[model samples]
Target: MRGPRTQTERDDTTVEIVYAAVTGVLLAGAAFALVMSPVLFLGDVPITTLANLWRAAKITAVVVFAARICWTLRRFGRR
Candidate 1:
């Protein structure tokens, strides 16, 4: 039989794997958004809102990355 793993050890392993994956996904997504968001969201907005939407998308991307990191940490302990 396989040896037992305490919860913390399992959690650590899961976190290490998932965090790496999430980090990659977030990075790729952010790169795509940085290129496409300004065109999609602000392409036709007035002068002021154009810049605003671009900035907002960027800020949101940062928040998304942060949230994913936290989620990876949080999901570690789950069965």
Candidate 2:
């Protein structure tokens, strides 16, 4: 078993967590906007299709957010 984490290790973890969350939000927002851009740029889209696109955008945002967080943590752990 490993020993307890030192102060610097704890601080590094806190920093990494914050970094992951911030970057995740930014990346997720960008992904959501990208996915929903068709609604903004295209005219006369049907309401149903618009709703579907919105749903897809939300899903994409969530996936991107989770992925970024996991990737960041995993990469940090590997270092």
Candidate 3:
């Protein structure tokens, strides 16, 4: 059976919603970066540096996000 919800649970739900909104922004930024990674045939300009930077940031964001979720779960489980 489902347990009664506490203030902490409500807070976590709010946090998760904020996290979801942030995720949309992150995905949009990543997609933009991927598209901009390659250049048109200028015959001189190399691939952009922002791609690598954005890629690294994306990976880090995912890891930290998973950690945040775990933290939220722990908080919810507590009395």
Candidate 4:
């Protein structure tokens, strides 16, 4: 027979579940951005120009942020 979970165990499980959910959401968002960003590009602007480079930087920042969020969430989930 299985024993009932202690309060601390229940809290830990809840925290782990939340972390997993957050990581999943972040990964999905990152994947969607990766797929859609190029399709919504700014036409008429050359890729080598400052304006296009700035757009690229913005997308890179978003991807980096999402990756970091997922990394942190996984680290916490393992605790």
Worst 10 residues of 1 by lDDT: 35-44
lDDT for residue 12 in candidate 1, whole number 0-100? 78
What TM-score, to 2 decimals, does candidate 3 have? 0.40
Query: If scored against the real structure, what TM-score would every candidate get?
Result: 0.50, 0.93, 0.40, 0.50
RMSD of 3: 6.9
Off-target runs (Cα >4 Å) in candidate 1 are 1-45, 77-79
**Per-candidate clashes, comma-separated:** 0, 0, 0, 0
Candidates' C-alpha lDDT: 0.69, 0.97, 0.60, 0.66
Q: For candidate 2, lDDT tens digit of each residue in 1-79?
A: 9999999999999999999999999999999999999988897899999999999999999999999999999999999
| lDDT per residue as tens, model 3, 31-61 | 5555544543334453465556556667765
lDDT (C-alpha) at residue 66 in model 1 = 68
Summing lDDT over every window of 10 consecutive residues in candidate 3, give the lowest-scoring window: 38-47
**TM-score ranking of the models:** 2, 4, 1, 3
- C-alpha positional error of residue 24 in candidate 1 after TM-score superposition, expressed in Å: 6.2
- Candidate 4, residue 49: CA error in Å? 26
Query: Which segments of model 2 are wrong by more than 4 Å?
Result: none
Superior by TM-score: candidate 3 or candidate 4 = 4
Q: Write the per-residue lDDT of candidate 4 for residues 3-26, one digit (tens) a residue.
A: 997999889878766776676566
Q: Which candidate wins on lDDT?
A: 2
Model 3 error, position 35 (Å):
18
Candidate 4 residues lying further than 4 Å off, grouped into runs, are: 42-79
